[model samples]
Target: MLKKRMINLLATGFYTGLSPIAPGTVGTIAALIFALVWIQKYTISFAFILIFVCGGTLISQWAEELYGVKDASQIVIDEWAGFFIAVFGLGVDKFLLAFILFRIFDIFKPPPIRNLQKFHGGIGIMLDDILAGLMANILLRVALNFF
Candidate 1:
């Protein structure tokens, strides 16, 4: 009942995005969950891109209709996918840093990320997060070096 409605409203990832809490914040936390569970199993690189490609394509389409907007904030499958990218290759365990760095990069949307969003459909929906994830991973690596 309620769960289904929330699913419909969120288009899954979108609902996660629309959280009264910062959408990026929730998305990054979700990412940490994924990282903790998944990194133990497969190569984070493969998993990150795979999740990005699959989740972004399906949910972005759902969100387009659900929000009546091309890329609504509520549609955060993008975030989930993107977060995977951020922490993908690093193999770091500092959950808080991963979350913060990922959120910052996602929010800042620097350069290529901001430009990438101009695309429509899956690519536009998904690319920004991939870039954000990469940026976050780099930051994570740098931070790890210091700490």
Candidate 2:
């Protein structure tokens, strides 16, 4: 029971995923606030993103079993992980841009991003968002160069 609860807590982004509308967006916003407040250095942010990704994978796999749904809506830790990746090493000023771009990529799931969802279990749950974040990060870097 405790183990399930703990997984639930973590997988839900501390319950931000429980939002009735756009749970993924809310969870990403929560992650953004956390990044802005506590993640100051690039190294620390990278480490945290790694942790979120690995931990999110395990937790999401368990969440899928518990919820009896593949990639349950309440499991938003993937979003948290992805959002962290989106803003990886970027300044606070770019956080909003990263968030917007991440959301667009995630929602649209262009090309390979959507294809990742076909994989099963935690990898399937996390890969699409991971690709979206990577896309966002790359775009943000290129956009910054031009502007």
Look at candidate 2 and tell me the lDDT of residue 51: 81
Model 2 Cα lDDT, one tens digit per residue, 1-147: 999999899999999999999999999999988887776544436667788789889999999999999998989999988888898888888999999999999888999898898899998999999999999999999989999
The parts of candidate 2 lying over 4 Å away from their true place are 40-43
**C-alpha lDDT (0 to 100) for residue 126 of candidate 2:** 95
Residue 138 deviation, candidate 1, in Å?
2.7
TM-score of each prediction: 0.75, 0.95
lDDT per model vs. reference: 0.70, 0.90
Residue pair clashes in candidate 2: none
